[model samples]
Target chain A: MSVTGAGRPRLATKKRPGDTAREEILDASAELFTTRGYTNTSTRMIADAVGLRQASLYHHFSNKDDILDSLLSGTVDEPLAVGQGIQGVEESAVVKMYAMAWFDADQLSRSRWNLGALYLLPELRTDRFGSFRESRFTLMNLYATIAGGVVQELESDVSAGTEELPFRLVETIVNGRADTENGRGSAGLHHASLIATAAVRVLGFPGDIDGIHDRAVRVVADVTASSIFEKKAGHGQ
Target chain B: MSVTGAGRPRLATKKRPGDTAREEILDASAELFTTRGYTNTSTRMIADAVGLRQASLYHHFSNKDDILDSLLSGTVDEPLAVGQGIQGVEESAVVKMYAMAWFDADQLSRSRWNLGALYLLPELRTDRFGSFRESRFTLMNLYATIAGGVVQELESDVSAGTEELPFRLVETIVNGRADTENGRGSAGLHHASLIATAAVRVLGFPGDIDGIHDRAVRVVADVTASSIFEKKAGHGQ
Candidate 1:
């Protein structure tokens, strides 16, 4: 049975005892990994923290590294899917674009501090989850598509390629200076939200959807458009 | 006499034979503190890394925490001086503004990865050397002065307060989604460079600067102006 069974309390599953124990183990592991780094944390610590014997903990997971992988994937994988879903939608391109960033930021803030530390670990860097290159690329592509749709919607003749758009848009939003050191709340979140709102408005999106997604889309589009145009003009000089 | 002078190639003057050794210990400690976090690193490891006995290492710095403070102060204090120096400059406000950010980025990048890790440590959050809050606030004040100068140069009737101008300008530049995690390059360095350039241009200074800064300024100015106007218009809504 899955960790979260339908209509059942999360910890109170009717599945095999092993499955229930595994879920408990993962839950405890996630908290520890998030607070203490993966390397500093030990299997014995995890087992003790979860009120299980060290050997019992071993029975649920192979080792500390396995727990690390499971914890990270569980948090990020769903967010990635949500981002993908937004990309798939053909609604107002601006709406789709804002949704992707909002969801990503929300998910990242929820787990990024611990997960970000994991990325920095030497062991994880070489492991399967080390390279976030694929996830980044996918998200960037979605941003570019959304940006292009906005440009088209604005009725501008500018056909800036997708490759260029994501770099310009995402760079303005995700650069680390805007985020807290541990990747919690910081100027980055507020800036992206505002920029996204401005971008949609500038792209001729109706002001009806004044929610977070709409506001963020408008801000991002406006700032991005202005920045790109100015850059192009400066090159001419 | 000075810390750097302690590690000299020639004997210069007949100093204590162990003077060079003391300097070597500090130097090694600094490198370790930059790379390995304070809690993760131990005095014995640092001493061993420097090819010295732990007792010899203790003779230079009192403990691990003391070494961390020394490393952090050495790394960050000079940048703070540069920040102060630019603030004191009698040059055009735009020049002063640009120089502040330019120097900050240049110095911060000299040891960015280490400095970034230093900022991430929780203990440092309360410690003066560890907290970036003061330094960042000081820098913001400088940016605000520059932004105010730009308003005056433009002869715009809109009178923005010093506090508001910095927050607005920084918010516009650093707050975007592209500037956060999942964004490319270092956030602080990229934004600082971009803002330094933009502050100069937006202040209506003669635009002989490089293309990137020039473009960024123009774009940022336009967005800031539009956002302000929009906000005023929507104040009642």
Candidate 2:
């Protein structure tokens, strides 16, 4: 009765960061899953981390797979919706490309845990994670779509299918953060705009993208302040 | 004694590719670790896949960690040596960048299994894989050095740390292959030169890369034929 949920009383007081019990579980799971290997971390361990009994943990997540699925989906769903929402925005492809890169890379970098690191978990290769993979692929396609426009606008000779490079360039921040966190490389290798610039540059953006940069920054600020997530906040995830 | 190594009899006939038992073990481990999940795979599973007794597997590798380490190191060691050897090659940074990207990405694509998938293993973040992480960092720095040369040659205004993007762009092929194999994307998304072009282009190569592409192809052909591995062969692995 002390806690917000219908679950039994917590064995310990609130300690994790999130506002709700499910979010608390996710926050704890994210830390444990990324630090301890996914296969190494168990459902019981996750429950214990969040100060909840095993039964209460199941009330939120059916199993470890569900917890991981929710964690992975959290990283992508916003970007996927945001990327899709902006498809019809009246900005040029260059600005759109910059906006998406800035937003997505920033999300990957700013997340409390580097859940992006889990994108390659071998467990994800299974059918259980197929939806996550598809959402990711859809995000890549959105990047490619915007990047294809940049390719056309620039008239660059970049090979076909190279459009995916922009998205891939953005995703490199995942590794950049991982390596830097491990103390293996220089710091700030994954700065948001730096990666955004490089993501656009990968399309042969040529020298002096200052104009595109300013416009895209404005676009990012404008669209994100009023993105679809806000428009449909209470419609249900 | 029918087999080459000093171990017990085999459990199955030769089925894996490799010139030696060590190579065969690596091949088997690469496939299993990338698919079955690294933490889930036991030494016995690898031995069974390779048709060796668990004792024979131990004779070649101290444990599962050692096998995983050897598999990962195999993917990076050749690139590091060749990349370092060519640091002084009489070629433009553009050509060197092209050659390195082409060679490294091709190695990733051409590998029988997507061992590059293991590069992000959380277990690799541990001290046990410190040497492998260091070698990979060395390789990235080599790419950055060559990429830095390209930036200077072009007088690019890229951010100070952006030299790393060229290397990271080449690595996208790892994800590209994993995605394609999962039937999530097109087949040739990981093609070597397509990605190499995108990698070099990230350095602001601009249009008309045909000349640089041709020269780099020649560099790749020349250097790989007489590289250090051949010169140091039989000097002891």
Candidate 3:
């Protein structure tokens, strides 16, 4: 929320400056890209918004695509870094999961509207912006790794050989494509967090392994199964 | 997927020979609005796309906003109509839930890209468009009503009076949001469907209700409890 001098309105880089100009450019680009969209936004418009000449803007970025690539890459990398930092903390899996969710929620919510806008834009999916694919994979991997660690730490008897418990657990929480546009709300996030937390807890963490696995299994089964049953009843009647 | 008029370009309107030209203008406008965005898409560009004079186009729509308003209202209304059709059907709560989910999902996926685009546009959100607020409210109410009915049909002991159950269940399945750009995927959808089904089943249906309820409750308890335990264990470590 803090705007530094680096982000202040200055003349365009007809005369080359340092990384400060680059930072300012990106800051402005993220805002515009989120609100106006990439295809609709022009380099000149970006320069005008930042008090720079169109020609000068090119000195910093070869084209508008460069700015977009930079913006998406930078934004996605931050969360991954945060995840990595927490991994080194040596905290218990449950605490780690909470920490990760808290971090993701905090960061995502700050610019949730814009981030949502960016994702919805079809242009990002095209090959022109390959960052989309890479960033997505990176995020999935991060979640799986963290969730897997928690699973291993909690479940002593359950061998990790049969299934990728952490990946599924994280996927369960994070996946939201179902239920249409309504699916993307605060409620979904809460459900995912609850499910992930429960999964980790049931796998038997720092507590007594006895009964924990059964408890966790029963919880998942009941929640999933009951939902299915309810839907069938609605249909039958 | 079927185009009504394949090779032959249908007349934009049959109201007036002159109005046909206007219809073509609007048709072109809708396509651009979905792809290029509202603000970025100019009246001149729209007219050009339709092979018409800009002045002639204005004869139909007062301005670009008029074109956008028409497109958005139509999109919103179509879904509302589909949702309304469900109320007339007399079925069990479980069946209704599934049908509603299916309907919602189908509509969303069909207009997935456009909905995101239109929703993100700032001008569209402003008060220039009449009754958008009412439309949105109506949609939310429709979802709540459908979800509530499903929950009621599933629960046998209405004597207990669990009012919040409907809201919680509906919100969990319908309004759950994701951090990713696409906002959930196939896996998320499956999970939500499963959860909804399980919830209804546990509440119990008519035949062999007691047996089903007993089994459901045990399963839910075990799953919920186990996940919680896993979370605690991870934290402790």
Candidate 4:
């Protein structure tokens, strides 16, 4: 709601001379895209928000599609990279899954996440977003892989329901919050841990639920708070 | 995408004299509302799509808001009514939850559910849809009520995690499909069963997963296909 930058004229002011139009446009567009959805947001509105005339806005990008392309790459591509990073780690699959969910949640809590939610809108599913869709499914597949490991370790049969259930459970928990105005702030991390716990439970992990809950919370916090999940996970703290 | 009804212009020709203008208008609006979103969809475009001049469309609806209000009551109000009907039933809370998830999924699978999905659009979440929002939360609270019953029946300590997990889990599965152009058709019922199974599992239900899944499928089909989950379930089913 505070994103409109009210009363700030589109003219280049002397005091804020360092701000580039591209960055300003991106910032303004992100706010509108998250708060008002991609389709409802007009280029003129974005220009008006950033204090630029609609014609001047064309200097930076050809049209709205160009702006959306930039936003998609900027916001969505990183998490896919993070998912890929987690995939190459030497840690156990359960730990990798925890790290993925944890970091993914933290990244989603950031302001850029509003742009990511745009991927969910029906109108935005054009070929222009094909890579975003691919990356998203890749990320989901990573969760399924980690979850499948847990099912194997537990010796449970991979029934039709159980195969996709854990991934969907994790997705529901994470994506459910994507639409809220401001992300959960401090509670986002807690929700991430809770999602991890529920996800493991859905996989039929048989440890003590409370103990797993406590350990899972700490594991996600530690993993997301550090770069260890990306490199080799270092233990012995 | 067939929702556009591209070549099928609105006409009162002898061949289609039975089709009412109101129904055609609603159908066209629902298609545009779901695909292009409410804000992006204009009355002019809607009129054109329905083969009416922009001015003539006003005879049926004063504005887009009136059209949206009718769409809400037509498509979304039924689910709310179904939820209310379920609330008055005498079946077990767990059973009610399954029945709710099942019928809700079935209703969502109907083509009209696309209009229901438009409620998720940020632009559409205005004062006009306040009743829709209230009805939505009331339906969610029904799920919460049922989940709470499972928690109490099992005497498990209710933590923050389990409190809303079941409702969200069911929502993730059901609402997740709302964006699909065609409801899963025959596969939709299977997905509904899977959603019911997962929702109950989230509540820590101890029954056989497959058995519960089968029963949930049958219960939902019966409730949705017939009116049994209401009047008949008012006794004991």
Give the per-residue Cα lDDT of candidate 2 at B68.
82
Give DockQ for candidates 1 onward, in order.
0.09, 0.69, 0.06, 0.35
Displacement of residue A72 (Cα, Å) in model 3 is 2.0
In angstroms, give how far residue B61 of model 2 lies from its true place: 0.9
Give lDDT: candidate 3, residue B224: 30
**Candidate 1 lDDT, B95-159, residue by residue in tens:** 55556555544444443233444433445545444344565455455556656765675553332
lDDT per model vs. reference = 0.48, 0.79, 0.48, 0.59
lDDT of 3 by residue, B38-84 (tens): 65689998877866556666666788877777666655564455455
Candidate 3 lands at a TM-score of 0.52
Candidate 4 residue-wise lDDT at A139: 58
TM-score of 1: 0.57
lDDT tens string, model 4, B1-237?
Answer: 112223234343322111556666777887787777777789998877777667667877889988887776655455556666665656666777777776665555544435545544565456776665565566666667777877777675545656566656655543455423332222322366666666666666656666555655555554544564354323110
Distance (Å) between predicted and true CA of B171, model 4?
3.3
| Candidate 4 C-alpha error for residue B208, in Å | 0.4
Residue B70 deviation, candidate 2, in Å? Answer: 1.0
TM-score of chain B of 1: 0.56
Q: Give candidate 4 regions above 4 Å deviation.
A: A1-23, A52-60, A110-113, A170-190, A209-237, B1-10, B13-20, B51-56, B73-75, B173-190, B214-237
lDDT of each residue in B88-197, candidate 2, tens digit only? 68988888888898888888888888888877777888899999888788888899899999989888667778778777877888888888877775755577888777
Least accurate stretch of 10 residues (summed lDDT) in model 1 chain B?
B158-167
TM-score, chain B only, every model?
0.56, 0.93, 0.55, 0.73
Q: Pick the candidate with the highest DockQ.
A: 2
Fraction of native A-B contacts kept, per candidate: 0.00, 0.71, 0.04, 0.37
Which structure is stronger by TM-score: 1 or 2? 2
Q: Poorest 10 consecutive residues of model 3 chain A by lDDT? A: A172-181
